[model samples]
Target chain A: MEVNHISKSFGSKHVLSDINLTFEDNKIYGLLGRNGAGKSTLLSIMTNRNFADNGEVKIDSEDVSDNDSKLGLMYLMSEVNLYADGWKLTQIMKDSESLYGGFDHQLADHLIQEFGLDVNQKFGKLSTGYNSIFKLILALCLPVRFVLLDEPVLGLDANHRELFYSELIQSYSDNPRTFIISTHLIEEVANIISDVIVLDQGRVILNQPVEDVLAKTHSVVGPQKDVEQYTKGLNVIGHDMMGTIRANYVYGDLDDRILPDTVQLSNFDLQKLFIFLTNQYEGSGKNENK
Target chain B: MEVNHISKSFGSKHVLSDINLTFEDNKIYGLLGRNGAGKSTLLSIMTNRNFADNGEVKIDSEDVSDNDSKLGLMYLMSEVNLYADGWKLTQIMKDSESLYGGFDHQLADHLIQEFGLDVNQKFGKLSTGYNSIFKLILALCLPVRFVLLDEPVLGLDANHRELFYSELIQSYSDNPRTFIISTHLIEEVANIISDVIVLDQGRVILNQPVEDVLAKTHSVVGPQKDVEQYTKGLNVIGHDMMGTIRANYVYGDLDDRILPDTVQLSNFDLQKLFIFLTNQYEGSGKNENK
Candidate 1:
């Protein structure tokens, strides 16, 4: 699937601007961004739930706008509730099967048993965690090639979140497909996603594989003077100071300069890298294409 | 502060049962639990916003019920909105000062500038993340000895959450006070909190310092037979299998047993320990007093 020159605006505000992305086959992508970064807007446009003001979305050279067969190939489990409030879980499942043409009843039953969800309970009466679980069950059991999950574990506890991730991986292994998950919990999904797409101020800032992104970032910790000397002229995105000690986060390759005895270099996690990258944009109030 | 034999029930459903715990002075406690685990109910009862069916809350050996002085020393920042919807940020801060007798206007101003919050906007018009930021500003600036924050970083982004944690640590350092933060995101708070209190099904399952709890847990990874053999006679809580490799999570101290060359041992984080501990209770459907 490809999103070519897509742009969206609300009144005078631009929500998404000339967004271009391509999601390859059978890979999990983490769609990440801060609040109001146009992640949800882009997802809605891609799935045709909302219209883009500019370009188009295509799958296998076929435009997805008003195309029933093309739209049917993708499933988007969003925050909006499309089913009636009075409908039970069973009724919702039946309706999903009818609309999607087929549903994995065996997988649905397994998920229900694992999550301990009551099928007889009404959709509106479920708690926040249960509501998320129900939507997740539907997304996992659908027979679509692409599944887009927006805040999949919104109100889930630690244990439930673990179970959901494990189940998602199991289902993906059984049936290879594309999964694009948008969530605020970056650390939880860092290991699960093979690729990452980050949006900032209605623009795609970073789009690459997880391993490639992590390979170029480093954290150097040492005395203030030594750390600064070693990281001079490099892409020093951010730093933290405590008395005489300092830790500088570098975002590019290390030079061949000999390391100081007082300094120690290590790898940083995705969350820390994300914080520095986004903070740079906000601090400068300017968008620099990467 | 002490919670002595507190119990609460609503329509034959017990929210908290015989809960007893003590909070030492100038410490940060991570109050962890699943949904409907009575964390909010307990905080409300402690702040005199709600009445308990049994027992009482005491500060410095004096009952807090209907005691203005005692209640004044502690502040509860809850999910419920206590201010009028039409009030602006400045008005809310002024009211807080009048009600609490004093407020840190300097700190509040600094936070407002850092977060870029618009003070002229009404309380109801702010977004979810800003709303949380406003409440957090109030909680940090008030001149209270005890502050109970229930999901203080509810909708905050990663950058904001990191900033909040740093400011919290700085505030605690400047003026030593007790902070009881109840949240579902455990890994983020694992390093910031001094101690941990876990509630499972309205019961106090684990109460210990963070280091003490982490000290007793170990993760053993190797072949299935070797891992099981090494963890034999220990409290094995959970295990994960990836093809032939198996990882067993042990809760108690490791015995002085010989290990195979292929086996590896390492310390697990707080989130893993919480998952294993909580899962043990749910899998058995029986509560054993620890």
Candidate 2:
């Protein structure tokens, strides 16, 4: 899917400002950013659920303006509600089969059994775990080539979240399709992503391969004097203090001389990277590309 | 807080079965499990919001069966309500102050500015990000000794979630309090926690210092043969396949042989550890302690 330079606003408040991004086929891309950074808006425009003030979205280099089948190229922000209130689980499977061409009833049925979801119960009253199981079933069962999941693991406990991750990765691999996963739990999803696109203040801040992103961001903890000297040229993410010992999460290669065995080093967790990058932009009042 | 052989059941469903836990003072513990793993059930029982089928909870060795105030604890489980729809932000603050005994008006006012919340807006109508901001503000304003947060980052964007973590760690440093944070986002919160507890099947599975847990867990990824041989006799977390190359995460030492230059290793991410530990428990149908 190709998203041309798009802009959106609500009256005078700019939500998405001149955004351009593309999702290559058959790979998972992590759509990341701080809250209110216009990720949802950008996603909305790409899926054609909401109109962009300017710009266009293309699938196979053809516009997705007014075509239902073409719109099938994408699915965005999926969560629970596999069956609404008073609806049976099997009814949802039927509805999905009717809506999406790629809907696989066999897969859905198989998943329902695997997850221990009762097909007879109304969907609204399912437990939180069951709700996530239902969403996972729908996401995996969808016929769409581009599946966009926004916070799909919200109500899920740790076990279900991991299940969803492994299942999503496995299904995406088997199907060979583009998957855009939007999540706040960056580090949790970091290792699974092939690519990542970070948005800040309604614009793309960083987009690169996952390993490169992780490799470039790191942190160091040690005595304040030694850490301060070693971190002179490094990008400091943040630091903490305890009496005299200070742990500074700096973002650069360490001068090993200053960082001995007593000091510790860790790759900056993606969530912190998100925070620091967003804070940098917000402080400078300038977007990365701007 | 010490919970002594607590049990809770609803109708015929046993939510919590003979659970006993001792949450230490001045430590941040991750109360982890899958959905419906009885985390919330156990928390509710400890807080007196829900009566246990049988058992007792003590604070500082004093029985908390009939006393709630002296516990000096504050619990925030996802969204309670800021009442923002019709009420002003100021009005919402006033309302929350009355409900929490340790409410600090000065701190509340300071956090309102820190989060950039609009005081004129109605409580129920704030944007999702601002709603999270409000909850964070409420959490910080309270002067409780022990704060329990259950999935506090529920609807937050990455930026807000990051800010919450930094401020939370700082708060713990300044106040020296016990924080029991329950969330599925493990890696994000790992840095802030001093200790870890992984729960599965309504029981504590892995509980120890974070450092101790990480010592036995590491991922060795490379060629399938090397990976297989290296992981022999160790607890395998999970493995992924990319053609002939398989990357396996294992729990145990990696010092048998010098790892090949092609093989990459990393300290076990907490999220992975949580998933592997819990999934292992569920699959084996046995508790580690048992």
Candidate 3:
């Protein structure tokens, strides 16, 4: 799946403007941005459920909007309304079996039982976590080449969320499908995302491999004086100054000799990195919510 | 604030059974659990909005239900009718002032501008992030002893989340209050939490300081053979074997002599830790959404 030169707006408001990016093969790509950055709009357009004012979205180098084969290539926005509130979840699975070619009935059943979602209960009666599990099962079991999840685990508990990530990785390994996930919880998904496409005010700001992204973004913690001096020439991403303990994120390489042994170093906090980058580029002038 | 042997059941299903916990003053507490673990239900009971089938929730050594000052405690859920749709937010603020004492007018005004929330706009017309900011502002501006935030950053983008945390800390410093925040994005808020309480099946499983939890939980990476042997005596929190690097979340202070310099050591993933801990107590059955 891929999109190029996409520009969309509502009235005078430029929600998404001049966006160009590609979602390659079977890798997990993060579709991230601030509210009103047009993430939903862009996904809506790609899925052909909504149309874009301009730009092209293609699946397997073919226009997805008009092709039925490619139509089966995607699924998006999980607001489970299978027929009616009276419908049982098992009946919903039967419907799924008819819609998608790669539907795995056995796997779906196993997952249903795993999530403790009662097969006998009506879909409406299930708890929110069970509801999220239901969506996750269908998405994983159904045979789709490209899957898009937007806030998929809204109501999930800690246990269910863990299950979601494990199943997601398993699904990818077993089926080799492309997943485009949009989420506010960056740290949880950071380990899984092969690539990240950061959107700012409806424009694609950064699109790169997650490893490279992390390698370029580094955080160091040590005595306040050492941290400040070491980060002077580098692109200082963020700084948390609490008394003498100053933890900072810098976008640059470090020489071994200059790196002090007393300083404790760790990988960047993706959540903090995301926040600082978005703010540094778009956070200024805005009255600090802090 | 504290609860003694609370239990609430709906019809035949048991929502919460034999639950007892305490919330300390002038500190941040995390109320964590799966979606249906009665987190909301428990919060409702403590706030005096709902009645528990058994047990008592106390506020300041008195039953929560009888105290008029309980109104000072703010409970903000993701989905609720804070104000009627057509009413302007400014009017709602005026109304809020009457409902709660010690409301800060200055902070409210600053929050409105900081988050780009239009005070004159109708309440329901606002975007999700904007709505979150507005509600957050109202909760923080209230001169209250206790504040409860349920998925507070619902529609907020990455940048706004950091801002929200900063604002939260700043407010707490200005006026010491007890905060109980329930969220699934554990890693994002892990640093800010003074104490964490993990609930599963409506029971508290692991509750401790952040440093204590993280210290006892560290990841060991190497060949699966050595990794498994090295972690035999330790409580295994999580493990991931991918080709060459086999990582395990070992619970113990690992001896460096046994680990050797060749094996790569990594910090524990908190999100993964929450998942594993909950799964151990309960199960990781998939939520089978068809």
Which candidate leads the pack in DockQ? Answer: 1
> How far off is residue A27 in model 2, in Å?
3.2
Cα lDDT tens digits, model 1, A183-278, are 889999999999989998899999999998999889999998999999999998878776678888898899899999999999898888888888
| C-alpha-based local distance difference test score of model 3 | 0.77
Per-model i-RMS: 7.1, 7.2, 4.8
Chain B TM-scores, listed for every candidate in order, come to: 0.95, 0.83, 0.90
TM-score of each: 0.95, 0.79, 0.84
The digit string of per-residue lDDT tens for model 2 on B101-160 reads 557777666556556678888777887678777777776777766677777777777766
lDDT of 3 by residue, A1-290 (tens): 77977788899998888888888888999877777678888888888877778888887689887787898878774553444787887788778778776578777866776676778888788766677677778888888878888777766766677777877887798779789998877877999889998887888878989888788777878888888777777777677755677777786576654777756777775666677777743424233222
Q: Which candidate number has the best lDDT?
A: 1
Docking class of 2: acceptable
Candidate 1 local accuracy as lDDT? Answer: 0.89
| Better by TM-score, candidate 2 or 1 | 1
What are the runs in model 3 whose C-alpha is more than 4 Å off?
A: A77-85, A120-127, A218-269, A280-290, B70-78, B210-273, B280-290
Model 3 / residue B163 / CA error / Å: 1.4
lDDT of 2 by residue, A1-290 (tens): 78888999989988888888878888889988776788877877787878999989888888887877778767665542434587777777677767875587776775565556787877787876676677667777888888887777767766667666766766776678888888877877888888989988888888888877778776777787877776778777666666677766665555545556666778876777777777643444122111
> What local lDDT score does residue A70 receive in model 2, on the 0 to 100 scale?
77
Worst 10 residues of 1 chain B by lDDT: B281-290
